[model samples]
Target: MNKGKGRELRAMLRDWRAAAGVYASLQWRCFHQDGRFDPFLDPATQYRKDGAKVRAGIIRQIVLKHELDVPVPEPVKEGEKPKKRVLPTPPGLSDCLAPMKAALGAAQVQMVQGQVIGTLKSFISNRQNDFVDIVLGSTIDDLGRRQLFTINRATAWFDLGRSVKVETVEIPLSARLLARKIMSHILARHKKPSMKRIGMVVDKRVAELEESRSATSHDLWLKVTVKSGDHRSRRIAIPMRSNDYFSSRQGERKKTFQIIEDRETGRITVGVVTDVGSSFEERRMAYASRAQGPKALDFGLVTMFASDDGDLMGREFLRKLKSIDTTISGIARHVQRSGGKPRDSKRYVAHVTRLRGFITTELRRILNRFVAVRKPTTIFLERLNFQSPELSRRMNRILQNCGRGVLRAKLQALNEEFGVESHEVVSAYTSQTCSCCGYVDRRNRKAQAVFACRWCGRSLHADVNAARNIGSERFRSIGSARRVVRSNVLDMLVTQHVQRNTGERGAPADPRMSNPHFAAWADKARLSTKAA
Candidate 1:
């Protein structure tokens, strides 16, 4: 009900925000987007090209303001300029002011220009809702409103000769742009609390993760149960399969081994791991088939363990034996902050000691504890260039940015700390470079891991060699993802030597092995020794 002129309206908004305890500020860009504007690359460009005119204009404005006792608007420069990079245009000024701005726009357009206007008036500490009120209550008439030019959102007020009727101005979403611009500035400069998505180079090939960015909609809920003596009643979901390894019975079982030849290649084939798990399940299904007719044979994932009344504490014992982990992460901010640093104790302190502990501790508890028999001495792993573009495209950007870098970094770092040398180096040519006969032909390396080398009659396992090569390549380009000369993990000759030493234990003693003349002599010597 108390609004006045155009300038008075702007002043009202400013005074309202201040009076209402709002801390919002204004940013203004003096020149709007126009095609025929001088492109300025650096601050020196503005100084070099429009040094005289711009300086003269500033001086003229200052002198005119001095003569007329008014304040002058600040010049537009970058770097030294503040975070806010917006310039406000008064109503109806965009059409008329386009011509005036065009003249100065010739003075080299600084793309990121901004002016900040605070809430307080020149002569009055009290917030005034309109220009009329400020002018009426001030010692200086025009000077009170002239100060509005300090803010980028109010730059048009000064540029249009400081008349103060900026009502109906198109408020650019400059604050949003300013927020993003400031974040970029911080990241580029590597300032405190910076987040940079730079290349995760391991040798020349950068690491990237191509994964399901979204967590899988968990299906197949695991339902645990126990059967002792025969009293089983409740129904539950099928239990999840776990990798179990236990010792077999000592007595010889009905098992046979024989060599077979490939039908096409006439090549000899080796035996495969006995499907004991499948056989055990089959026996169970056979018993069920007798009890429940035809449908009982459809065992699916169901199981019934033979037990005795002596082992009667059934469900409780099984539940105790079966270990499970409760992972807590990626929750809402409120929960994250509320969780706090795991209550400060030896157990809690160890986990809170940074990501190394988190990764290594969890890796052992989750992965290592389950493996049976001989603990893997040389752990075979596919060295995922988690920083690769292929992986980046496949995986979510957040994981592409953090998961690989953090995981790989933590793994290597933990290896040293825990005295565990369990890591591999991946050759850039894992996919292109053939593992068989050391051939580097990209054409033959089709698909993911199936490789048929043209040079040799050797077929290579893509993922296998890639995994082996990952272990193999580690000799040269170890302890560095941040810097590598090129993607080549190592030259071919070095790779061959490393592979031979690792694969065949330095040199071959058996005659049927590799060395030819030695093989002939050794074969003859063996025959002679047998005769003697």
Candidate 2:
């Protein structure tokens, strides 16, 4: 009876504390914005400010709220112009209170001041004598409302030496059957927008072009006009960069393309950069299997998905997202200059969304091809839980739009259909540890793309090295009570990796080696250890 009274008191205190916090926050905003010291104002303003400050201090004691660290932009160069400042406006009281309800919902936290609420009360009413406090909980109804105190935890003290027995229940699922079920569930539950829409858009654009130009011949090039001030203009040539990686002038122009001038404005115009879908297709095809692997009972596909500096693929994707962010900046600039509509983001947003869809879809398809070639595969993935402050807003946006969870769900569905398995393991130290020598140090990975081990003095591509560690890391087994931690076995494979690139000579190994395999590296490491 006393415990019940204590809970009611605490619940009332919590509500009062929340109300005080809301008022304090509003007062703080007012004082900070408009309540600054003004000699022209009345003396009463000073007293009111002092009282609000005291109230803010008192509310801080009762409320447990932590502020999020907001990111700031980098400083501009010395000669560059500074941006204009914008005035801040405080949100309404109801807007401030809405987040409290969301916070409570997420935590499944509730407080009831008086009597038990609903069906949960009935379940506990029968056992009321045995319990000191009866907690009630319920789901949100169709009316977008949930019962008060619908979720809760309680503290109760029992007589000494009293114990309860718990039973273990087995969920009946065979390895093959489980895989099949998982794959089926994913295929049914996960959905992606059709790519046919993009094709349709492209086809419609082509049809419009044909309708406007009846004299057009069978050619890849199309003419476009540019308008400017009235002045005669001449055609100029623009150069194209070379594709050879080893060429000194790789980024320099080796060939020039003809550019035409507009008759009306005399402004020089060039062809629009489009029809690059073929390039994406080529990149997608590169990830496909060259040859089929031997049939085995188990085939594992380890996916390394992370967004640290060491992640090359992540960094590359971030670069693409950053390029798109330039468009966002341009949009913002346009809005500021013209004082345009505030909510005009549909055009740029759609572009980014479409690009993200293409990238993620291509990634899934590539991974699926690898699985298809090697059936009965178990895919290893890193358990991603936290967000890193080191990631830029652009990088975070790319990751969010890419949808890692969606990819995992799709992989799970693959398991059901193709006997593929997906498993998650702790991601820590995977990028730092050397896969060949088990030598882990911060200096091993200094650059974004390079991993040079300090202890073994072996170097490899950072992403490939991290992927190797992920593929080799120990994982949880079915029916096992605890997760397994595998022992490090760094062996002669380090020597083999060096020799493979340097041809057994003492010279340094080449940084770029085709067909890097983690299993082969493991085998070499084991052999090297035995030879020693």
TM-score of each: 0.25, 0.33
In model 2, the Cα lDDT at residue 529 comes to 57
For candidate 2, give the lDDT. Answer: 0.38
lDDT of 1 at 444: 56
lDDT of 2 by residue, 170-288 (tens): 21223223223323343345342221111001111121121222333322322211111232222211222223432332122212222333322323333322333444345335433
**Residue 367 lDDT (model 2):** 59
Model 1 lDDT vs. the true structure? 0.31
* Model 1 / residue 436 / CA error / Å: 4.1
Question: Model 2, 148: alpha-carbon shift in Å?
Answer: 23
Q: What tens-digit string does per-residue lDDT give for candidate 1 at 46-91?
A: 3344555555565645555456554434544566533232323223
True-structure Cα RMSD, model 1: 31.1
TM-score of 2: 0.33
